[model samples]
Each structure stands twice: as C-alpha cells, then as structure tokens.
Target: MKPRSVRTSVTLAGGVAAVAVALAGCGDTKAGDTTSGSSKVTASPEAPGETGGSGNPTGKATPDTVPGHGKTGQTGGTAARCTAGELRAGWQRQPWSKDGHVFATLILTNRSGRPCTLAAGWATFGKGSSGRYQELRTTRAAMPGAGTTITLKPGTSAFEGVKYDATQGCPTIGGFGVKVHAGWNDVPGGSGPVVLCPDSFTAGTIQPTMNGVNFHS
Candidate 1:
C-alpha cells in the first residue's frame, strides 16, 4: 500500500511538470507577437510612384525622412520633407545664358510660414504655355552643389540652374513646376518660366546659395 501511494504521488508531480512546460510554450508565442507589433511602430510607409522627401520614392529609404537624416551618409538634423502645399516656385534667367541655351535659376520658396528642408535629388517640370497647363519634358544636368541638403527657413529659398534650348522651337509658358522630395507645385511669379520651353529643357542640382554649388550628396 505504501509503494502504491508513492507511485501515485510521483505521477501527479509529472503531470504538473508537463502542464508547466505547455504554459511556457504559449508564453513564448505571445512574446513573439508582442515583439512584431513593436517593430510595426517604427516601420516606413509604403507609398507608390514619385518620391517622398529626400528624393527617394515613398515606401522606400529617403534621406533625412530625408525626416530621418537618411542613409545618404549625409548627417543633419532629422527634418521633415517640405510639402508642396508649403512651397511656391519662380525662376530667373542666368546672366551668362547665351542665345542658343537658355540658362536660368529655378527658385523654390518656403511659403508655409514655417521652416522645412528640401532633400537632395529634386525634380523640376516646365509649365505648359499658350492656353495650356502641360508639364514639359525637361532633362537634368550635372552640376556642382546639385545634390545636398537645403535648409529653407520661412521665407527662404533654394535655387537650381536650368538650361534649355531656345533655338529648338520650344513653346512659351506662364509658369514652371518644381518637385523636390515631394510633389509638384506651380512656381508662378514674375515673367513666369521664361527659361522653361515645353520641348527641350535641362535642370541642374539644387543649392542653398544662388552663386555656388555644394558637391556633397
């Protein structure tokens, strides 16, 4: 009788151990789920077409966020990308632009009544002219200070050099469009997109200064 009692007690203890192991397994699974949920908090947004701020398409890596001061290896304060709603555009022809090539500086102003950053690798478009609002096909040119973090304070401006062919039978327009890491906005002010011809145009890099370019990415 005593031996039988001891066997029963041992059996009960084994069952309790098995139950503990099962509970631990369930706990591990729950912990894994919690970790995954935490990661989602910091994940990047998945956007399509065009780019986010800092010139990379949304849903992908963009410099600074180009809000994160991204992997461009360029370091700066983590500033949010400037939005189209906050920006206004305009242009001025460069003094040295010749007869064949129309060289001009594309100016982007921060009209948001606040400060923002325009990441590198911005895109520019020509406004359609002659009772039209067409986006012209403009090319990009390689130049000094083309790709750099441009900090635009309230009422401040960023500049880009544009070179297009005037002799190529390009059409006239009332304004130009500027696209940075964000969407396109009409830069309509003064003479409007004079350097912008609908057919052939080339845009240079953006810089904080109108005269000199920065060579860093």
Candidate 2:
C-alpha cells in the first residue's frame, strides 16, 4: 500500500508541473502580441500636405489683386464722370507773367453731393459772348507721361493751366472760357474777361499734378 501511495504522489506532481508550463507559454505569446501592436501604432506617419484635421492651408488669407478692390470713400470704386451741370466753373490768373505770355488756372469745382471722377484729356478754349460761342484754335501738348484719372470729392476742385501770348495784341476778349472734355462729359471750366492772344492760345492737358501742366514753358 505504501509503494502505491508513493507512485500516486509522483504522478500528481508531474501533472501540476505540466499545467504551470502551459500557463507560462500562454503569457509569453500575449506579451509578444501586445508589443507588436504598440510598434505599429507608433511608426505610422501623416501624409504630405496635410493641414491637420482642418484641411486648409496654415497661413493668413490673401488680399484681392484686382484693380479697385476693397477701396473706400471717394476712391472706393468706379465713379461717374463729372458733367457741366454738376460742376461750378472759376478761374485764377497767376500773378507772374513770363515771355510776354499770361498764365491762368482754370478751376472746376464739384457742386454735386457725391464723388465723381475726371479723365485727364483734351481741353478746348472758346469765346462766350453775344449768346454765341466760337471755338478757338487750341494746341494740345502731350503730358510728360500718362495722366491718371482724378477723383473729386464733394466740394473739391481740379485745375488746368491756360497760356496765351499777351504781347501779340491779338484780342482783349470778354467772356473767355474753356470747355474740358473728360470721359463723356464736356464741362465748362473758367471765368473770364481775360485778354487772350487768339493766334497763340494754348491749353495744357488736365492733370492732378503741376508737372502735367506747362506752367513754365
């Protein structure tokens, strides 16, 4: 009976050892699977040109490159050309005389309540008397460079220079005036009983700057 008991005990111990070995193998396989999953997660990379989850470029928005875009006030956008009815005409004779010639500035003021644009273009001179108008021969000189469109706010003014040889004794004419053609508007600009040399009557192109006018020569 004692020998039988000893054999039984040995069999039981062997069975327990086999069970422990099986558990150890299972633990090692689970650990290896966990490690492989962690490596795959860490190694993944984002694709090129990806802007996070938003999908938009990561920078400031660009401004409009079109002409007259996002402007404000009188210069905000395309304005209507000034007309004779909306403008008040005036003149200022310059103090200094040069080379027997008289210089004067033809002034055009905006009388309308809104803003308007004026093109720098040809100006015509004429005599306004006896309820009749006669166009004077005007010599047009090219501007130093290209002239830009001028915008005038309400109650503002633009100017053009007038020059004539006073020494020639051509005529001391009353009701001398100028008609400036800008865009589709032909507006009268000037107040005169000005003495004009009709033969040498010359007008400069309308400009926003003095450089465009032949003030000196």
Candidate 3:
C-alpha cells in the first residue's frame, strides 16, 4: 500500500494494475434515503442535543444510524440466485481518527468453482429537516475505471482497503453511516450484499479541546 496522501490515486498492492472490481454483487441504495426498507432504522444529528447516544467525552454528539445503513433500491429482500452457488461480499468501516479520517475494507469470497470480479464506491449523506439528506459527497476513484478487479479461488476471500480524508463536508467520517457494495459479473450469482456501519464525525475534540455544542436558532 502507498503512503496516505491527499492526491487521488489507487495503488494496487500485489503489483495488480487497472482491474476494476464489478460491485454489482451487492444491492444498490434506495432513491431518497439510504436506510429505506431497512429494519427499524434511525437518524441522528451531530452529537450534543440529539436524544440518542450521548455525545463523546468532548461533548460532541454521536450520530444515530450510520449513513450508508439506510435503504437502497425498491426491490427489498435477500438477493435472488442468478447463478449456481453462493457468493459472499461485504465491507467494514474502521475509524482511524476522530478528526475526520477513516479507512474502509471490501471483502469478496467466491463459493463457486471459479474466480470473480468486483467494483465499489462510497455514498455520503447528512441529516436534514423532515428526516432527509442535507449534504452528499460522491468521489470518483483516481483509477482508470470504476473499481479494482480480483480473482478468487473457490472458498477463498479477497480483501481491499481504501483510505480517505473525511472533512466536515465529505460525509465518510464524522457524518452518518457508510456501507459496502460488492459483486461479480459474467459469473453465476445473485446481487451482492450491503454492510452498513455507523460513523461519528462530531465526536472529535473542540477547537482547543472541550469545545461546547454549536446550537443554532
């Protein structure tokens, strides 16, 4: 892996080049809310005043449901079988720092007797009035195509991680929830899986530490 920098680029670890993963294996997001159709979900604002998880020690609020955990697409339910065997795909979000930095990893395992391709990207959102999104950030990978492609042996899994700087506006960190969408095409299987993880942006320290809540009128 390359050193973490602001420059937008995808550097493959095992000398792999320009292979975009076909992320269609996982389900897509719903039109309006990311949590639509999800089981009893909730959305909370940036720490402090909200009636949810108490604010981090610094007094910042902890966001409710993570951003990407919301619903995606109208067709709800477990994926249908389009292929012979079962293919597993999922991603996890790990908090790097409370100061708006995060890392994400994608995992794909092929149960069939062959290899597969995968693609993935992140969708960011913020809470607004009437339980809607107020802000969104869409990032295009610095690579040549949509995502990286990897071949997996039967019963074997592959892992990939991407580091990002989540400023106040970019909703990856300190914002809402995040989810991973992964899949393989030209192979037998159903739609991929979506794993949602909640994130806390306002959990960071105040300007000089102990920065109180920002109450607006």
Candidate 4:
C-alpha cells in the first residue's frame, strides 16, 4: 500500500508541473501579442516616395498670378498729371527768320518738388496788360503727329514751337506770353516782352524732345 501511495503522489506532482508550464507559455504568448499591437498604434504613416512620411508628390511650389506682381510691364500705379500752377514758362527765339515768319522755342519747366506727367496738346498765347488778359487765336496748321505722354521729374522741362507770321501786316503787338494748359490747370509763362505779329500766330504741340522751333513746320 505505501508503494502505491508513493507512485500516485509522484504522478500528481508531475501533472501539476505540466499545468504550470502550460500557463507560463500562454502568458508569454499574450505579452508578445500586446507588444506588437502597441508598436502598430505608435507607428507613423509613410510619406509618398519616402520611407515613413507624406509630402507633395511633385515637389513643386505654386506660381504667382497677380498682375504686375512678378513680371515687367505696365505697373498698376500711374503718374500724376502736371498742374499749370506748378510750371514755369520761358522762351528762346531763333536767330534765323523765313517767309515773313519769326520762330521761337517755348519751354515749360516744372517748378514743383514732385514728378508729373505732361500730355501732348495745344497751349494758349496771350497778353496780360491793363489788368486784363487777352487770348490770341492760334492759326490753323497741320497737327504735328501724335503727342506723347511725357514724364518730367522735378525741375525738368518740355519744349514747343511758336510761329509768328509777319507777312499779313501783323499788328504791332508787345508783351507776348504763353500759357501751358496741363489737365485742369492753366499756367501762364513768359520772359520779358514777346513781340508777335497780329492775326498770324500759330503754336505747336508740346514735344518730348528738343527740336527747336523749326520742328513744327
């Protein structure tokens, strides 16, 4: 009987050991599965063409579309037109005379401190005497080409031509002057007395470049 009991105890102890080993194996398998799930949750997504991150597929930046933003051409800002009050006038008479006509160069100088634009157009010729202004009529002549929009910096100048015809018995006029009309401003200009032939006066458009008084004809 003692021997039978000893065999039974050995068998029972062996069975208990086997069960413990099986439990340990199961616990290790469960721990491994938990570690693998944690790694998947913390992992970052892979980028395009990269090992782990996402970015622009083509890798090119966007371009600008705003006008005058990055290209040359007309800028959005325009120069301000010159005012008559900001101009100073002067004249240079040519030495030569032809066909009973005297020629003189008209100069319109900017007196303001800012830059301004001068449009191509006609100017007024007149005399200021006895506290009254008398405007002279400009003889009809062929228009001198198209006038250009000229930009003048501060202290800059523009030029024009004036023709006085003495062939038609011009009245003896003295104290001649020229007036520059820029936009809404009409500024008078002259130096000393301007001896002009009456009823035969003509003026030319303001030119961008200096061509003397003969450029009009």
**Local error of candidate 3 at 99, Å?**
2.1
- TM-score per prediction, in order, is 0.50, 0.52, 0.29, 0.51
| lDDT value for model 3 | 0.26
What is candidate 3's lDDT per residue for 1-217, written digit by digit as tens? 2111000111112121111122222223222222223333222222222112211212233432111111111212233321313344333333222353433333334556544333222222222211122332222221111222233445654443332343454322122221122222121111111111233211111111111222111
Local distance difference test, each candidate: 0.36, 0.37, 0.26, 0.36
- How many clashes would you count in candidate 4? 3
Candidate 4 stretches greater than 4 Å from native: 1-77, 98-100, 140-144, 167-169, 180-195, 212-217
**lDDT of candidate model 1 versus the reference:** 0.36
The C-alpha stretches of model 1 lying farther than 4 A from their native spots are 1-75, 129-135, 168-175, 179-199, 213-217
Query: For model 4, what is the error of residue 36's alpha carbon versus the real structure, in angstroms, after optimal superposition?
Result: 99
Worst 10 residues of 4 by lDDT: 3-12
Q: Tens-digit lDDT track for model 4 on 1-217?
A: 1100000000001011000000011012111121212221121111111001111102111221101111111111247765655555544444444455555445556668877666534444455432233555454222243334556666766655555555544444434433333222222322222334545555554555544223323
Q: Which run of 10 residues does model 2 get worst, by summed lDDT? A: 3-12
Give the clashing residue pairs of candidate 2, or none: none
Give candidate 2's TM-score: 0.52
Which of candidates 1 and 4 reaches a greater TM-score?
4
Predicted structure with the largest TM-score when compared to the true one = 2
